[model samples]
Target: MKCCFGFVTLFVCSASVQAQEANALVQQVKARLEKVADYQATAQMDINVPFINAPSSEVQVFYRRPDKFRVQKPQGISVLPKGGVRINLAALLAGNNYTVVDAGTAAVGGFNTRVVKLLPSDESGPVVLSTLYIDAAQPVIRKTTVVAREGGSYEMLFDYGRYTAWGLPDKVTFVFSAKEFKMPKGVTFDYEKSGPKKDPPKGDGKGRVVLTYKSYTINKGVPDAVFKD
Candidate 1:
C-alpha cells in the first residue's frame, strides 16, 4: 500500500513485524532464497515519470549471492531508483544488523501477506527502515516499502510466476516520487533561469518503474566483471 507521508506514516502501520518468530519467518524466506546462488534474467523495463520522456526497452539483469547486481541495456541508459537500494531482496535482508516488528497484514497478488517492519540498527546504512509484505503460504516477499537514510524512498510490488520457488518475481513494480528523484551523479541539464527559480512543476509526484521478466537462467555464474562495468 502507498503511504501519504512516506516513512512517518508507515510506523503507524508497523506493529510487530520483527519479533521472536517473526525472525523465524524472515529466516524461512531467506532460506528459500538461498537455493539460488546466482541468476541472469532478461526483462522488459518501462519507466513512467510525469516529468521525463522515456521509452520502454529490454535489459539484462544479473544478480549473485550476498549482493552483486547489474542492469545491462546495450547502447542505452537505464533509469532506476537510487539511494543505495539493491534490487536483490537477499542483499536487503542479509545480516542481523536490524530489528523487526509485525507491521500487520496486506494482500498482494491476491495473497494475504503478513506485513513485517524492519528497522536497521546501523544509522550509517543507506536503508533506514523497510516494511515487507510476506506471502502467507510460501516463503516470498510479496511487497516492500523502503526508506533510504538519504533521500530516496520507494515501494516494490512483486508478481511471481515462473520462479516463485526461488522467491523471484516474474514482474516487479517500483513506485516512487518523481519530484524527489535525483538525477544520476555526473549528469546535468540546462534549465531556464526564470528569476532565479520558479515554483517546482505542479503535479502528483508519482513515479514508477516496471520490470517484466521474460526468462531467467538460474544457477549460472555471472562473472564479477559484469558488476564492475
Candidate 2:
C-alpha cells in the first residue's frame, strides 16, 4: 500500500511540474515579442467566401511599429489602425484591456504547445476573441485564431523558419469560416446576390496566407511624410 501511494504522489508532482513548465513557455514568448520595436513585411491575403467562384488574392505591404500597423492592400482598401498603431498584433491584443486565459495544451506544427485565449474586455469592440498557440520548446508563436464581432473566426498558422530566434514569423497562413464572408456589393449595394447561393469551397476548412519579411530598418528616424498619402 505504501508503494502504491508513493507512485501516486510521484505522478501528481510530475503533473504539477509540467504545468509550470508550460506557463513558463508562454511567458518566454511574450517576453520576446515585447523586445521587438518595429518590423516590415510583405503579405499575401487570400479571401475565400461562399458563392464566390474563385478565391481573391491581395498583395499587401505591412509596416508594424510597437503597437500600430499599416496594411496597404490592393484597391486602396486599408484597415483602420487601433491598439496604439505601433504594436504588433500579439502585443496589441494582449494589452491590459484584454484578458488572457490559459486554455490548456495542444500540438501545433508538431511542437507541443500551450493555448492562450485572449478575450477583449469590450464585447462591443471589433474583435470578439483571439487565441494563440505558443511553442513550449522555444519562445515562438506557432498559430493564432481570431474571431471578429462582425466577421467570422479566422485561424492563422505561422511558420517560423529563418527568423525563429528573431521572434518574428517568416510565414503566416489564414483559414476562416465562409458564413462570415460578405460581398462588398452587399455593403455598397453594388452587386446583388442571385438565386440560391452555394456554400463556399471547403478544403479541410483551411486557407493559407504567407508573409515574407525582407528587412526591418529600426528607428531610422522615419519622416512624417512617409506616413502621408
Candidate 3:
C-alpha cells in the first residue's frame, strides 16, 4: 500500500510541475511583447511570391510610431505609408495575438524546444493559423508557421543572437510556400515585372522573404513631426 501511494504522489507532483511550467511560459511571452511601446529599427526584407511573375525584391524598412513606416528599395521609389498602418509585421507575426497551448517538445536550432500552437479566435482572419517553437530554457520564440486564409502557409525561423532588455529578435528567415504565389501588380505597379508573367503579371506557387533587423532604439520620444509626410 505504501509503494502504491508513493507512485501516485510522484505522478501528481509531475503533473503539477508541468502545469506550472506551461503557465510560466505564457506569462513570459506576454511580458516580453508588452515592453515595446515604440521602437526604431532598420530591416532588410526579401519578398518572393511565386504567383507573381516578378523577381524577388530586397528592401530596407524604417519604422517609427503609431502608424508610420517607410520602405526603400534600391533604384526604386520608396513606399511610405502615412496614416493607415494596416499591419505591424513584427507584432502581428511575432508578438502575442493568439491563445498559446503547449503542444509538446521538439528539436529546433540545435536546442530542445517546446512546441506551442497558437489558435486565433476568428477563423476568417487573414492569418488562418500559426504554430510556434519556443526555446524551453530561453523561453523565447524561435520559429513560427503562419497559415494564410487563402490556402498558403509560410514558415519563419528566427535566430536571436543579440538579446535586448525587451527580448526582441534581431534576425528572421521567412520560408514560404513556393507554389502558386503572386502579388498583385497594382500593389507594386511602379516596378516593372521581369518574371514569367507580362506587364500585368499573374501569381506563382513558392517564395521566401528573409528580414534582418539591426540596432533597435526602443521607447524614444518620437513626435508627430517624425511621421509627417
Q: Which candidate comes out best when scored by lDDT?
A: 1
Q: Write the per-residue lDDT of candidate 2 for residues 66-177, one digit (tens) a residue.
A: 4445555566555333321112444544455766666888998688878877678887876677777888677787888766665455566777776676677666554555
2 against 3, candidate with superior TM-score: 3
For candidate 2, list the clashing residue pairs, or say none: 65-86, 66-86, 66-87, 67-85, 67-86, 67-87, 68-85, 68-86, 68-87, 173-209
- Model 1: ten consecutive residues of lowest lDDT: 186-195
> Where does model 1 exceed 4 Å of error?
1-18, 76-82, 180-205
Give the C-alpha miss distance for residue 171 in model 1, angstroms. Answer: 0.6
Q: What would the per-residue lDDT of candidate 3 be over residues 53-137, giving only the tens digit for each residue?
A: 4444555555553345555666646645222112233445344456666677889879888876767777666666667777867
Candidate 3: what lDDT? 0.58
Better of 1 and 3 by TM-score: 1
- Cα lDDT for residue 121, candidate 1: 89
Q: TM-scores for all candidates?
A: 0.79, 0.64, 0.65
Clashes of each: 7, 10, 17
Give all candidates' CA lDDT scores. Answer: 0.74, 0.57, 0.58
lDDT of 1 by residue, 63-174 (tens): 8887877676765343233446756788888878888787667887789988888898889988888999998688899899888776557788889988998988999887
